[model samples]
Target: MSKLSPGEVERLKNSLKEKGYKLTPQRRAIVDIIIRNEGSHLTTEELYDLVKKDCPEIGLATVYRTIQLLEDLGVICKLDLDDGCGRYELVHQEENHQHHHLICKNCGKVLEVQADLLEGLENEIESKYDFKITNHSLKFYGICSECKNIKNK
Candidate 1:
């Protein structure tokens, strides 16, 4: 989790204000936690637990609402890894880059694949089908190295 710059914080605040949402203290705390744990891909329960440690008065419902708001505002992305739980991560405002995910079947550990592996494929698809590709979610599932080693042993 990397620290967010002051400008990034202001951008988020302004975006919220434009959407008729105030940067409430609780909401700010939630954003802070998400920003601090930037790539954690945390579930609602996990986020609630972490937020509760900081603001014990916060409720699960409030966390859920805040998460929905953030997602609607494009400040965070909701990820479905086919594990029966929705995960979330901050949307990198500066880059707006999309990365793929690798989920280990045995241990359920999710790893990020940062390379832009679909650029050529996207170009071909657009040219061949005459349809534009706006976004994509690509995930690969298999046993990770550690799990493979354990199975071998």
Candidate 2:
């Protein structure tokens, strides 16, 4: 009943082993919750709330530790929306850089932009400045269509 694919589970296991850590059941439950809510951008407290539904005995400290461990192992990454809280999402294997986010200023809804819209800009900057680009994060703030529609009504 694991949310993670077998391959993903094995990969996590191997990564943990490489770091001399074991994937305990509690850790597994936490990871399952993260995978279940892939785009949630969950904060540690939010994650703990969801994880508690499955693991009533799990502590917030455990969630914090596991999150740090997973981030350290590159299984996930932290995101700061400048909203006074740090959020987290999975580190997709296929993406060279994290996808951009569009945050609604009025309603505070966050939308993901799957396309890497800055590729050309990155290339231009690299060629112009002779700099190597490793990665980048971008977030746009504006009113979403829903908010605009509501306002226009």
Candidate 3:
């Protein structure tokens, strides 16, 4: 994914504005951090600590608020990953966000793979069954590479 341009940020602000979500200082700062750091599947508390470097007065509640606002605006995607806490990541417009996760049950490592890997099966399922397919999310659970090796040793 590409780094966000100034134009994109402005567009996002305008988009949220229409939704009645004011681009407050805390919200912008939080969004800016997420944009600047790509590929960060961060938790709310982690984002709060990082955002504190720029705005120490920011509260955890504020972070949570911003995250929800962003998600509502389709600016970011939230993933549960079947973990204890939810994680957040900036959603790329180029990608359809149609993918599955490979999660290591032992160590909780989650990696995303494009949904195309299941293209034939998805198509077959739709043809053989009676369901309109709009979108889907799949998650495979297993032990991670390191954990597998550890067991062998």
Candidate 4:
């Protein structure tokens, strides 16, 4: 079941309205899937397939358009995990920046690091370089503990 609340849906509706768009049924299904699989980092094709199960008559082009619309509205963001595929994840409203990702090299699993571990570094760089950092994306790749444990066994 989706963790999306009614308030969140209303907020999304308001966002779309502000952008001269509407939350159609197909679009709602896509958004529902995205919310349900919050950390899945689904690709456009993966999202399309999942939406097809719910909206059998939906077209790929419509999915693409909705993705573009949502992205333009800053409701989602694209991530590159160096896997030759672009993945999409929601831009959490409460987060000042997107959380970092830890990708397991062996099992190809991705874990989210909720801690903002780069504040000091970002501050140092901003002061030294006279730059104002607005946002950043970081990905760390390594073998996860589960993989290491399996290897030891």
**Which ranges of candidate 2 are over 4 A from the true structure?**
1-3
TM-score of each: 0.94, 0.95, 0.81, 0.93
For candidate 2, lDDT tens digit of each residue in 16-119?
Answer: 99999999999999898989998889999999999999999999999999999999998899999989998999887778998899999998899999999898
Residue 111's lDDT in candidate 2? 94
Per-model lDDT? 0.88, 0.92, 0.80, 0.91
Q: What TM-score does prediction 1 earn?
A: 0.94
Candidate 4 residue-wise lDDT, 1-153, digit = tens: 446577877888999999898999999999988988989999999999999999999999999999989888888899999999989998877888889999999999999999989999999999999999999999999999999999999
Q: What is the descending TM-score order?
A: 2, 1, 4, 3
Model 4, runs deviating above 4 Å: none
Q: Residue 104, candidate 1: how far off, in angstroms?
A: 0.4
Across residues 1-153, which tens digit of lDDT does each residue of candidate 1 receive? Answer: 576689978888888999898888889888889988876789999999999999999999999999999999888889999988999988776643568999999998899987768889999999999998877889999999999999999
TM-score preference between candidates 1 and 2, better one: 2
List candidate 1 segments past 4 Å from native: none
Per-residue lDDT value at 128 in model 2: 100
Supply the global lDDT for candidate 3: 0.80
Question: Which residue ranges in model 3 land beyond 4 Å of their true spot?
Answer: 128-130
Report RMSD (Å) for each prediction in the order shown: 1.3, 1.7, 2.5, 1.4
Give the better candidate number (2 or 3) by lDDT.
2
